[model samples]
Target: MSSTATKTKPSTNPKKKKKQQQKSAAKKSSAGDATGDSKQKRLATDPPLECSKSDFDSLLVDASGLADYGEASSELIDCARYGEVDAVRAILDVWSPGKSKDGDLPLESGQPARIVDAADASGSTPLHKACANKHSSTARLLLSRGADAHALNDSGNTPLHWAASAGGSDCVGLLLDHADALHSLGRGGRLDVLLKNGFGRSALTEAFASGDTATVQHVLNHDSAEEDRLIGGLDRKDASEGEADEVAEGKSEGAGEKSDDEKGIVHEFDFLRCSEEGEAVDSNERPTVLIRELVSGMKSMRGNDCQGSSASRLYIHLSFSRNPQPIKHADDPFGQAPEDDTTGLGIWCASLVMARWLASPSMVERMAGRRVRELGAGCAIPSLAAAVHGSPAEVIATDLNPETVENIRHNVELNSSTSRAAKLSAATIDWGDESTYPPDPVDYVLCSDCIYQRDIVPLLRKVVSGVLAPGGTFLYVAPDGGRDGLPAFISSMGKNGFERAGGREAPEGYRSNPLRSGDGEDCFLHFHELASTRYVLYEFRKC
Candidate 1:
C-alpha cells in the first residue's frame, strides 16, 4: 500500500491534523520492524472466534478503568471483527474515547492538565491501547485527535512501551520518529527510568535479563549519541589506579559521560566500564544496578581460564546438590526447589551439568571431536562443562548479555588451569551473526530454556538454520509454559523444517534450580530431533 494511503483524512482541526500526519509517517517508518507478513497472515486468518477486541476497545476507552465490565465497548469489537476501515472509523467516532466520562473533549475546552491527562491505570493512552488491539485505523484516528505521546500510566509506561512490549514494533517506531518520546523514564523522572519498573528495575536490565534483544536494542539506540560521549571520555580517562578514585566518584554523579555513536553496538554485551572501586566511570552510566551482571562480572568470581570462576563453579555445585530439600510439587522430576532455601546452587550447577550431558555423548559417537558452538549461553556453564568433558576440538559460548559473556570467559579460565574443566572459549553472539558462526559447520549446538519472546521465533529459526551443519544436531530445552509457548514454537518450527523427536522425560533433578522454570508450574524440556529420533541421543538429545 502507498504510504499516503495509510494516512488519516485531514482533520478540520488544523492542529490535530498536523499531529495525525506526523504520527502517520512515524508508523510507516517503523512498519518494517513489525511482525512482517507471516504475523499479519496469522492474525488475519486465524479463528475469528478466537480473535480479541481488547486491543481495540482499550484504544477507545484508553485501556484503563474498564476492568469492571470484564470488557470494553462491543462496537469497537465489531469494527475489529468486520475488518472494515470505514466501520471502525464510525464506531470510534461514536464510542467514548478515553476514560473521560464526557467523552473526547472539544478542542476549544482548553482544559487544565490534571491526573486525568495521565489517568492511565496501565501505561496505555487511547492511542496505545488501540494499537494494542491491532486496530490500526482507530489508532490513526486517536493520534489525529491529539492524544499525548508523552503521557504515562500508573506503571510509568508510555504507549510506545506497551506497543513495543506487545511486539507492535511498527507502532513503537511510529511514535518514536515523530514525537521523540522518552523511553526510559520512571514515574518521577527520566534518568535510571528503564531500571525502576513497578518495583525498581531498569527496563534495559529487564530486557537483557529476559533475553529481549529487540527491546534492549530499541532503548539503547534511542540514545546512541549519549552512549558515544560516555565511551569517548572513558577512553580519555587516566589509566593509573590513583586516578580511579576521582573518576569513580565523578562517574557516580554522571559527571563526564560521552555521547554514544550511531555506528551501533556490534554486540549486546558491550557496556560502559566502571572504576576499580565499583563506582561509575562515566556520566551516562546509571547508579542503579542489575545484580545478575554484577555477580557474574566480579573478577574474584572468575576462574583462571576466563570462563566462570570457582565461585561460579561452586555456586553451580551447590545449586544442583539436591540439598536443603525441594519445594512444593517437589515430587515432580523437573520441579524447582524453594528459591529462598537454595544457596543459589541448583541453577548454577544445573546449567553446567545439563550442558555436558547434552553435548558429550553425541560428540564421542558422532563427528570425532570437531568444532562446537552454543548460542545465547548465559554464564556458559553448559558450554564450559562440554568443553571439559566433551570431545569437541573447540567450543565457543556466546550470549548478547555482556555480563554473562564476561563470566563465560572467567569460568573458562578457571576450569582450564586449576581444574580439568573445559578449555572453553567465550564471545558475544547475537542470534544470526555469520561471523560468530564458525567457517566450518559445527558438530553440535546446545541451548537451554532460551525461548522466551514470542515474536523472536523467526529470528531464532534463522539462526538455527544458518548455523547448523548438514547433519549438525541442535539441542534445546524449553520450559513448556507461557501464553505463547509450545504452540507458537512448534508451529513456527514446522514451517521452518524442524521436527519434534519424541523425547525422554526431563529428570526431576533438573527442576530444583531457579533458572529452570519453564512456561508455567509444569514446564518440561523436550528433545526434538533434527533428523530421526533414534539417531539423536544424549540425555536430552533427539534419539
Candidate 2:
C-alpha cells in the first residue's frame, strides 16, 4: 500500500511541473506581441528618414523585416533620392513574389516594377527624385520597370517638369520619347507637354525660365510637331465629313473641288504676286513686284486729358520681289535686288508693333533724354519710326550685315526731314564683337527677332548686358515663329539682372490686319503676312 501511494505522488508532481512550464510559455508569447505592436507604432509615427547614404545603409540592414509596407516604402524613396541603385534593387528583390503578405509587391500589385512610382512624404515618386537629381540611368531603369512618367508631385510638377528644371536633357529626351510611344498607343492625354505647375507655368515654361536651352528646344520641337499632327488630323477629318455631307445632299461637289484648286494655285504663287483682288500669276515666269506702305500713328497715354493732341503718323516704305533675286555679293545675307536695295524687304510684324509702341507719347516721354539703340534692326523701320515720330534724344540702328547697314543709312536719310527732334544713325555692328557698340551704356536697347539662332543667344545676351545702363529699359519683340530657344533667351535675361517691367499686346488693328488691299494697305499686308505669327512686347528693366 505504501509503494502504491509513493508512485501516485511522483506522477502528480510530474503533471504539476508540466503545467507550470506551459504557463511560462504563454507569458513569453504575450510579451513578444506587445513588443511587435510597440515597434509598429513607433515606425508609423516616426518622421521620414533623411534621404542620405547613411540612413539608407541602416534601412538595408533591417530590410528583412520590411513587412510593414509604409516603412519599406519610406526607405525605398530615400534610396532613390540618393540614387542608390544597388539599394533600390535590394528592396525591390525582397518585395518581389512570395515574401509580401499577398504574394505580391507591397506598394503596387501585378507589376513589381511599378513600385518605383510609389510616392513618399511629399508625394514625390522615386522617378521624380531620380529625375530631379539628373540620374538618367536610374530614371531609364525605373521607366523600363514601368514607372509612370506622368505622376505629379505635391507641387503639381511631373517628372518631366523636374527633368526640365534640372536641365537634364537626356532624362527629358527619355520621358518625351516614352510619352510619344504612349500617345501612339492612343494614350494621348496621359502626358501633357504644356502641363502647368503650381506656378502656372508649363514644363517648357519652366525650362525656359531656368535658361535651359537644350531642354526648351527639345520640348518646343516635339510639342510643335505634335500640335501640327493633331491640327492636320482634325482638318482632314473635317474635309472628309464635308465631302460626305455634300454627297448625301446631292450638292455640286465641283465648287468644293474648284476651291481646293484655287487654294493650290494661291499657295504656289509667289507671296509678292498674290494681289488683294485674288489674282494669281505664274510666279516662275516673272518676278512679281511687291510694295508696302505703312502709316502708323501714336497717341498720348493721357487718354481724355490730351485727346488727339499728341497723335501723329509716320510713313514707312517697304519693297521686294515676290521671288528674291540671287545676291551678287557673296557677303550679302539678305539677297535683295540692287535696285530695291534700300528697301528692307523682310519687314517683321514685330518691327511694326515696336515702332508703334515707341511712337506713343508716354513712351516717348520715358525716352526723352535717353540714348536708344536697336539691335538686328531689320529694315531699320523701328529706328526710323522712333526717330520720325518719337522724341528720343538719339537713335542708333545697328545690323550685322553690311548691305543691311547701308540700307539703314539710306532709310535714315530718306526719313531725315521728318526726324527733327532726334538724331538717327546706322552702323554695321556685330553683336558678337563688343567693340562695335558704344563704350558708354545706352539708356535703352531694342531687340526684335534677334534670338532665332541658339548659338547666338549667349552672344546676344552678353551684348545687351554690356550695353544696357543701370535702371535702363530693354524693349524686346519676339515673334512666335516656333522659336524653340526664345524661352532660354528670356531666362538668360533674368539671370543677367533684368526683370520684366510690363508687357502688352500689339494694337488690335495691327494684330488683325490682313495684307490685302485696304486702308493702310501695306501695313495691313505686312500684318497679314505675320498674322499667324504671334508678337509679344516685353518691357524689361536692368536692376
Candidate 3:
C-alpha cells in the first residue's frame, strides 16, 4: 500500500505516547555497551507498543505511534493490532496487488518481507503488534506472508520477546514454529532469544517478567521439542516394516522405554524426602543412586552441552565442602536431584535463576548497603552472588542442616575474595525452630526452588516474617507449576501481613540482562540451568 493512498494519520494522544516512549536512564546510558550512541538513541525513542484507538471499537493497537509512516500503513498496523483478519487480508492484497492473482509473495512489489514487516515511527512491525496483542492468527498470517520475526522495534524487542511477555504458550509456540520454518525458507528461521531490549531484557527475561511459568517452560523446551520431532521422523519409516518386525523390535526394546537421552533425570518423586537429619535411608526405599547432571539440566543445564556436547563439568562451589554442593531449600522435589545426596546437596534451577537476578545491576542496587539472608541456602549461590557482586553489608547463607551449613561456610572460604571474607557467613538456621532465628536485622531474604512440599508452607512464611526487618523485601522463587505449594504459600503469606512488594524500594525494572551480568561461565550456566524448568520469581514485603 502506498503511503499517500489513504488520508488517515495517527491520532494518538501525545502525552500517553510520550509516557510509553520513556526509557529508564540505565537503558539510555547503557546503549554504548551494545550499539553506537546516535543509532541507539534514535531506536530508543522508538519503543514498540503504544495504546491507540483503531477504526473499530476502542481496540488498542501498538502502531508505529509515529504518524509519519502515512495513512495506508497506519491502517495496516491498526488491523494487525485489532486482529482484524479480513482487514489485514484486504490490506495485504492491496499492497501486493500482483499476488492476489497467483497467491504468492508480491514478487512484482519487490518482496512481501518489506511490506509485511514495514515499521512505523515506533519501529514496530505488523508482526510485533500482532504478537504483542497475542493475535496468533494474525501473526501466523504475517509469517506466511513474510514478516521478519527478528525485526526489532524502538526498544530492540523482536516479535518473539513480545510474544513471550504476552504470558502464554500459543504466541511463543507460533513464533518458534515459524522460526524453524523460516530458516528453511532462507528467511532466517532462528529467533534470537538472546537479543536484549533497551533494558537488556531478552525473550526469556520477558517470560520471567511476565510471571508466567508456562511460557518459560515452552521456551526452555524449544530445542528439545525439535529433537523429538527429528527422532520421531527417523523412527516412523522404520516402524512400518511389517507387524512382525515391529513386534520383534518392540519386544527387544520393551514398551515405554525412554531414550537414554533421559540425561541424568530419573523419575519424578517426592521432593520431601528424608533429609532433616541428613541420615542415610533404607537402600530399598531411597536407593542411593547418583546420575551425573541428573535430568534437571540433563539436556540444557550445561548450556549447549544439553544439545549434544560433552560434559563441561561446570559445578558451583559453596561452603566448607572444598567440593561443590548443589543449592535448594526443600527436597529437590520438583525433579533433578542428585541420587545419592539429599536435595540440599544438589543445586536447583530456581536457585541459579535467583543468582542471576542477584547479579544484575538493578538487583545489586537493591542489595547494596543492605543485609541479605538466604534461606535453605543449598549451595548458597545467591549468597555467593550477593557477596561477590551485590556489595551488600552482609550475606548469611542458612540452612536447617549443620552439614549444609558447614558446606556453605567452606564454599565461602574457598571463594576467599576480600568481599567474600568480609560479607559472607554460613550458619545453621532451623526452619522448624523459631528460637534459632538470629537477632541481626535482615533487609532482604532470598529463597528459591524449595517450596515444593505442602506442609512446609506455613513455617516458611513464619521464618521469613521473623527474620526480615520492617520494610524488608522477601525474594521467593519456585516452579510456577507441577506443585500445589506456590498458591498456598502466596495465600498464606498474603493473609498474614504480607503484600506483593512493589515501589521505589524494589526493582522498578531490569537495567541489564541479569543472566548475562555476572562471570560469563557462571552466568551462562545459570541462564541455561534456569531454562530447564518453569520456575517463577516473586518479591513481597511485610504489610
Best by lDDT: 2
lDDT of each: 0.38, 0.53, 0.52
- lDDT sort, best first: 2, 3, 1
> Highest TM-score, which number?
3
Q: Show where candidate 2 strays beyond 4 Å.
A: 1-345, 512-527
- Per TM-score, what order, best first? 3, 2, 1
Tell me the tens digit of each residue's lDDT in model 3 across 120-225.
Answer: 7888888887777776777877877667777877877788888887764567777776676656667565765555677556675566456565565455444422
Please list the residue runs of candidate 1 whose C-alpha ends up more than 4 Å from where it truly belongs after superposition. 1-353, 359-368, 418-423, 512-543
Over 1-543, each residue of candidate 1 has an lDDT whose tens digit, in order, gives 011123332211100011344423433353233323112111111112121365444444443333321123333333332233443443334333453344553222332232212222333445545544444444444444445655655666555544445444454444443343223322122323132334333333332233334443344333321322212332212222332322333331233542332111111110113222223334433111111111211121211212432322222222122212222232232224211111111122224335434433444455346666787676565665555544457778766544346545644543453222233588766665567655666666766545544655666667777666765677665533332454565565544455554344344333321111111111101111111111111222212
- For each candidate in turn, the TM-score is 0.32, 0.39, 0.43
lDDT of 3 at 392: 85
**Backbone clash tally (model 2):** 2
Error of 1 at 105 (Å): 84
- TM-score, model 1 to reference: 0.32
